[model samples]
Target chain A: MNIPTLSELTARGETPEILFWVGCAGSYDDRYKRVTRAFAKILIAAEIKFAVLGPEESCTGDPARRAGNEFLFQMQAMNNIQILNGYGVKKIVTACPHCFNTLKNEYPELGGHYEVIHHSEFLQQLINEGRIKLTDTTAYKGKKITYHDSCYLGRANGVYEAPRAVIEALDADLAEMKRSKTRGLCCGAGGAQMFKDAEKGNKEINIERTEEALNTGAQTIAVACPFCMTMMTDGVKAKEKEQQIKVKDLAELIAEAQGLA
Target chain B: MIQQILFLLTLLGFAIILRKRIVQISRTIRLGRDVKIDGPTSRRFRNMLLVAFGQKKMFSRFIPAFFHFLIYIGFLVINIEALEFIIDGLAGTHRIFAPYLGGFYTVLMNVFEFLAVAVLVACVVFLIRRNVLKLPRFWSAEMTAWPRLDANIILITEIVLMLAILKMNAADQILQHREPQHYPSTGKLMFSSILIPVLEGYSTSFLIFVERFAWWFHIIGILAFAVYITYSKHLHIFMAFPNTWFARLQPAGYISNMPVVTREVKSMLGLPIEEPGTNEPPGRFGAKDVNDLPWTSLMAAYACTECGRCTSECPANITGKKLSPRKIMMDTRDRLEEVGRNLQNGGNGLDDGKSLLDHYITREEINACTSCNACVEACPVLINPLEIILELRRYVVMEESGAPASWNAMFQNLETNFAPWKFSAADRFNWAKD
Candidate 1:
């Protein structure tokens, strides 16, 4: 269960191949913390040399920027970039699409440049590299699992296939919602909505999106973003179908299938 | 000779009006801040070809797209015959290309006839869809009186124009039969020939009058439409090409970084700035009006055809939130026009005590956006309403610090604790302890 931080690795004059950016949501959201642990477990099982920023890692300012507070966003971005640069980190992987998008696309201009990959793509890479192996008969074999495309991961960046590929590797039935991929519905937590009440609407966007997932007849709704995990889970509960359908992160599913959980 | 003089004068009048409109629209769009959209000319060209010329995105909805394709192709192909009309009017000749093109002229005329019929049918179907069937998109809150009437007027105008082409051809066919020397046989055009039976009973002189009247009507109608489009949402006909060409090629999710804010942040942090600082006073932190937006954004405002596809696909609008992306574009265009007229009347531009933010688009609407880029993705012409929303939101938060109270707390937490929540950074990896 031991996890190494970048500082610990650096104190020993060592560097991990990749830095696991446990985003604010991944770090604190109780439900999403399990996803963080699950992804960490998969990395350990695959023997990938990675370390978390832990106490040093700060929010990537995705929320602040999205909330239209550029000053706070840049301030946080600059501090994080300085820390990442000081650690000489060259590559990053995270379970949060928000962090993945900001660190990958938005940071280079702010002087933080690194090869950033979402955990979905990273998991697909691991499975492709034969680093992570699933048992022949896994927990989700032939089970209906629908992956909700996080707006950040799917339309924002174009990483639609990797998460589905990871789901396919579970030997599960991938039921796509009517609106998915490039046309994917937002889980309603984007644009800093997660931190605030939704402006009054007929229904919560997550409920609307979850209805699509439910209509797909998928027993399990899979997600890559922590925000989607929270929203979809709340949606399933709101629909009173939590007992019938479960929402799990891609990493959690992979970790379970690999018996690393 | 008298007819030729009248035709030239009419043409000159319409051309002057169209030119004036084009110049005014160009100036209004230039009122926006200049953004350097450079390099990668090849990609931009491909985008314009596929989105504008190819009508690729229209196919997303099969039925409407099929009918729209009819009108789009019909309009472009029929313009070829208008070229002939212009040449004939200039030289005082009837069917001038008939001798040179010979049988091919008949074939070309037949194709134009067929397209005219198609355009007529499509316009009728569009009219029915708008008024009869009442598609929700065409009747959104922003689609008040003028927009709804404007749509119907364009469709009805197209129908009239298409009919004129058929009537002109049908009368010309009869004239050719009676007076071969003056009328010269161009052969029977398919769709228009159906009208020959009805017109066969008319007197020869009356038939000539009908042909002349129809010709003038068709030509004048097209000229009027060309000028009318600059004032209508139909501006998409010409603006789509330029708008799609200059579309933000970056991924839909990439909100452009403000270099001005970046430099200021670097200075505040005591970090060495890379680019030299400007001595000129920093402009407003974000867009408060159309003048504060990038020129591409303003062009997008003019380019939007108010199809409501963006609004229909919008998550906020779908859930009955007041945020309609289509309304955002329409409001922007309206505000820009107001500003343009204000400036023209010698009033201060963007300082007429009316701004695009609260005056046109309300804070409630812009704040309702999920910033999911659904509107951006749904746009067939690549208009990013999300970009406009973000810009306005930036203005609200940066310039006025007018964010909702809860958001202010989130910002404070992000500033102090490095996360939206007040949780300490030390506990970041507490889950690992398990």
Candidate 2:
């Protein structure tokens, strides 16, 4: 992946148009790595000069903050803000709402100010600008696809239209769940709940949320946030319908439609 | 003169009980750490009107909302009758306002009668909903015997109190017809007039006794209810106003970073840290006890109606997690009350050694929360359980170093690698490669 680093770009006295924040899930989670690759490919295809923080990028400290580790969250956030300021980064695009939300909303208080855009919004913008073209014979054409709203992306930040617009650009039939948009249920990986063992309950939240998605009868469940992708994918597997129902990130769906994957 | 002396004693008793309860509650609320809650005055008033008086959030569900509205309006309007009762009791007079206002007083009594009936009906329906219908949220693991009994007792108390008013009116109407000198004929009481016929055959003395007994019972019950409510979820009747007024005006999802912790980080980073006069060695990172939380949060605890609206909407509770937002509030209130009692016994602050975190609320319940803010959004009175949960989690992580293994690893990755992964941050952009 010949992705340029801000440090490298700064060393060469060059600046990318946008900084690509490959969040922990994008950079590490095996399933979400494809989402990272797919989004990167879209950026390359659109001829957008973007650079990653590379080794300089750290966790947005969202989980730490949510888990109530204020000291750790501040520690991590301060380090990232210093590095971001050092590189003179202005605008950021990331594949995770957890990162997008923190960097955009939280870091400014700690003196890290930048225009952070979630990948869904960024993809919608690219499509609107006519930078990328979708052709016929696409896998998603006329297929029933349902998008799961990540809590951070949907209710937490109200970025509902962009992801749906990006999915609509694929010419796929979007199936709306009973609980969608503002009423969307969590994929169960939000807050710091992703890291802790779920308390005793009659059902796992992911299973219930996945049930809502499957009830839509969509062949493919689309997710914008990497966390949602992981959760929904687990949900699909739990229901033993992995072969029938495919869980893919919106970027992957776009990558497939544009033949960038 | 004897009647006036007895009434004064009753009034004095009520005042003393009310004063003691107010002092206790104010002391408990004072136990919380100070967090300035200044905001636009207009916005605060608007929130109180909308959430508290308007019952805006309750309307999300039609049936319960209707019943709740009836009870709430009934509770407020019936207080008018209480005012009249207090005046008549103090002056040793019967129907003092009746002759002054004439027909308007009759109309006022009718309206009060109508509201009392509505409130009675609403309380019965509420009792059924809690006990007979067994709403799942109400029956959660947290809704132990005391909470259930407390709710039932409140409803039953209101029912008896309303009946006492009607009985008193019925007996008084009969006495007025027989002996107009002693008991003035106050025209006709709407609901109680029907009961007049039921008590007509009794002797004039017996009728007066029944009227007097019912009147005294009604007033005493009112006084007792006032004090009992402080110990019950009914505290929300009063706390909702202040709780709604002090609610966070910001978006539900916006989490506030601690300024004290922020300063420590800036200092570590060699940034110009603003030192605000070293206050008790930077005082613990997050809330380990009730004293560590913001005063509004403690007020929220005291204000919880235990309606379980937050738990009903909670994703964690729905998913079978141990977390119940209602329980969090209940635990907080319980701990505050305990601390208040400890202080009354001459215990010196949090030095009595009991704390809110372990003694009242468990780490398991707090950990199960997903921080979705559904609980906060679901609460009609604007109580933020997430705030309390987050503070406790902070204590676990910062003070006890008791985070789960996976979380600790992620923390290590965040510290050393700048990401929540063991792989180097240098490989972050590798996803861009084919």
Candidate 3:
């Protein structure tokens, strides 16, 4: 749970336009952490007054909601609401669909409402708004990037193009997984599935989804959800082909191209 | 002739009354919460084509399935023949011997009678499986509301018609008209020749009376079944179409947004659901009774063929936890009727303005749901019990109050710690930490 204090929000006053929700996924892994940190820097350079929601932000209770435990969901919803209000926050941007879904959909069910945005959608808006420019074109070696859409973000929220637009902005080759967009396969992590042991099904859902990514001949896999990033990265390691392919969250990819070390 | 005509007219009028009652029952039951399923739509359509038309999802057992498929298809196709029989009989064509048939008609009647007997035999086994063995758990409970004498009536009716058809076939050939010496049907009922001569030497009035008796019984028995089929859970005959059409369009794990939160006002002790007024009342988070459900949820009850597919696939029922997905749908239908009757007069009949749990859903039954959505996946008609369970959980948590202590603590932990685990909220990203 990474949260911001009210004093910081109040100090910025009616002017801070962005609140970077460096989600559980972005904060957990080092490479992703560095990349998201760079994402913050890019937004700051783009003149977006963004503050990190650190430590006070908690899990989005998506697992509880999926597990049919509404008590737990309401608890998380009310808590997030209080914290967001304490910061006097009106807008939020996050990378994980799990968090995005909880904040966007589940919160209202608990009596709190806030304007929420996914990081890809935010980046697309920034680029469209001419916020940041890529320093170089065709810089990275071609690694046919394949994107895995998170279920909550794609099917649940209907946010499709912004992520694609970000990938296209890279001028890199893009291939699609067998299941993507609205029909995206569950990474076996939705509905508190991340908390419970995988039930009976041929092929772990996340691994099966990853194989679809690998089938695209993409050496690198990019993800929007922190759970997906972690799951796919773990999947890549399990096949012992870690030395050959790499997993990157969207922000890290943007940061790498920005020449950030 | 007067008694038979009066009996037929009386039965026809009775059928109209029964039809009206069943439709009213259907409307009342289909009035609860909205249920959404994520199952594939094309699969449901494809399956119905195979099952209802091809009789596909029926028992895998060979003999019964064969018999049932024949009976099912025979009843459907042979409907035309029954209409012809009724029209001819009503026109005063009560013949003492073969009247309409020119030899060929006799053989066709023989074949039709043979098929009808085969279907009836198959139906007897179905009755045994349901009543004697109690193989389908819901079937026995479902039987309570149906006419108790149905099984006996169906059996007696089929046997009598079969014998009468056999008698008429052979009698027409010997006493009335003779031709087609090498016919296939004549050999099967060849024994009827012994009885035909005894009748042949009799007066014409006696023969005409016997023929009228057989005609009346066959026509009346089948039409009664048609009306009965619409009145009961066996109403699946008519309801299966719209029921299946409403089934979840994807897989079971798919969830459509829920419609309401239901709570028994008597049992509910927590958040007061602001009555629907100037403010948008906080949406109902769970279901407390049949009335709490959307109209579509009630429609799901009617659509259920009482196939018990949901119960058979339910992991909860397998472990003896006492939650039958089949029973949930059946119970909803039953409760709807019971409750609807109570409310039909515009008063809370069973509740007395009290909580419905004392009579409706048991606590243990409520807890047994895994929310696995298996029942939804297995159901061809697409009733989502998971949504109902979750909505019930919401009512319990927010209003009726008290839940499993483990869930309670986890709910608290969910507030401060991002995970249900007691870990600090800041650690939500810990899994991603290398």
Candidate 4:
């Protein structure tokens, strides 16, 4: 039972409770949910009454579509559209880029459309609006961390700064990947790749991406995409940097600054 | 004497045919990518001079490259010698016009003849390498159905070209004004016998007669080969320049925007939701027909040299996933041919056209691709597989409704959970360890 559906929001006169479309990466990866929840709390404490999706929130048909299961993808897309329309939720927020992309881009195929923003952009907006206060000093105030732009978030949707802004806002030392922004290398997680194996290539994309971050001498690895965070975390562990470095999402970084974590 | 000139004119016709074919192929390959421009201005210019006129890309493989260089330079330099010999025959007299052309031209022609010999030797070695030694790696290129025939034609053409180049020297040696009747005895091939030793004790008249006879043979051979090459897969000589030049401009990540699916001609706006147009719309969002494909899709067939580089790097193919990168091009070619064949009988392809996804490619094959872009990268021609596959997926997801079982559940979960899995949407930030 999802109370935050688009229809219910419109019925309740909250024309935009800010429908949060949590992606499967965020759903299964509990760490990301914390980030979203923290972002959500900003809206909540602001009395914005942000509507968080529940049981009705599922996978963005992207994985299905990438898997060539277009029928199932459209069904999911159509179902989600109906869910959004029923709730009359015009604006949606997401921590996962894949969800943001699928809903914002792929949903029209199934006839569902809405105003969608990446959590970074929404948070940046909130920060700009002065709804959320942050300490100029963060846990990683002097620590160097590199931010990996997720393919879906940065390349597909062009949401580069919001996450970086969050990191910079936290007053953390930031580094860059060689192939950042438009040329950002895939984290071996696009087009259903996270669910599959690395095909023939020089390096596993996560490791390759991790190596880029590592090359920046960033001790802490930060990412917005759940897949990127997980993949980078795994890459760090494999490189035996588990003891030397740490991985954190933007939400967690913001939360840390506020002493919430 | 007049027969020699007629023969040279016949050869010129052949070169004209070849030139026409190469141009057509160039145009066809230009159609494949979505706005591919080769390097920067200087780079394109340099590449055009080097790759197109200079034959630079061929040098990537040394043996073949070496031979091809010789043949190419050989013809360019000695082409006038063959032409002049034809004119001499037509004039019904033989004067040493080649020497009168200028000392530099005479020396350059001599050097070109020697290089032509090198080219001949190189071609033979390459042919042996490909056919007798059976370099299995080249099987992809060799197995290109029509390409194999083209290869044979190229081999014959090269042999003839070499004969022509060698004969230019031969005709000069055998048919000059001093020794016009020595054609039978002065038949020496520059490719086979080194000119230094063969010129020993040879009379000047014999040399001129040989040169004249060889000149006629050379012109006919070069022309015939050119015409044949136009319709062949080796059409890359003309096609590769533009194909490599107009590689994709953007990073591989840019997915082309899907067309607006609207009912009316106008009224489309950002955040497409309803039919904003004045006319009725189908409300569907994916390409439904060949007409729906980006023009790039059609261009793929021409850009494809059937090199199999794409198939070689394809993970799906290596994993036995049924998708062959070469076969994709072949399939495209087959469809185009079918369409053309049907059109010849006064039928539009619409009635005969079938969905390639369901016909040539199975659902399993489509699902098997990881979309890694290895095929895209490995392709010497740089055919972007990611875009093609995604478009196919769009058709599947939006138009066809075909999908795997687990994939279906994933989509269902996406709708229900606002994600792709069975988890709640609230737990996204639970894993922060820093």
User: Which one is best on TM-score?
Assistant: 1
Per residue, candidate 2 scores C-alpha lDDT tens digits across A1-261 of 688888898899999999999889888788898888888888999999999887667788998899777888888888889899988889999989998889987899888999999999999999999997876436888999999988888767878899999989988899999877866788888887777667778898999999999999999999988878878989999999999999998888888888877
Q: Quick one: ranking by DockQ, best first?
A: 1, 2, 4, 3
| C-alpha RMSD (angstroms) for model 3 | 10.6
TM-score of 3: 0.57
Residues B1-434, model 2: lDDT tens digits: 79878988988988898999999999989988888676698999999999999999888778999999998998889888888888888898887888788888878888888888898899999989988999987888899999989989999999999899888888988887788888766678889898887899989889889998998898889998999999999999999999999998765666877988888778777888755536676677788899899888999998898989898878888887788999999999988888898889887767777888988888888878877777876788989999999889888899899987888887887778777668887776666554
What are the per-residue Cα lDDT tens digits for candidate 4 across A135-161? 536467877878887767775666778
Ranking by TM-score: 1, 2, 4, 3
Report the error of model 3 at residue B111, Å.
5.9
Q: Judged by DockQ relative to the true structure, which candidate is superior, 1 or 3?
A: 1
> Runs in model 2 with CA error above 4 Å?
A1-18, A40-51, A87-90, A120-145, A158-183, A200-202, A253-261, B172-189, B276-279
TM-score of chain A of each: 0.99, 0.98, 0.89, 0.90
> How would you encode candidate 1's per-residue C-alpha lDDT over A127-146 as one tens digit per residue?
99999999643689999999
Rank ordering of all candidates by lDDT, starting from the highest: 1, 2, 3, 4
RMSD of each: 1.1, 3.0, 10.6, 9.2
Error of 4 at B267 (Å): 8.8
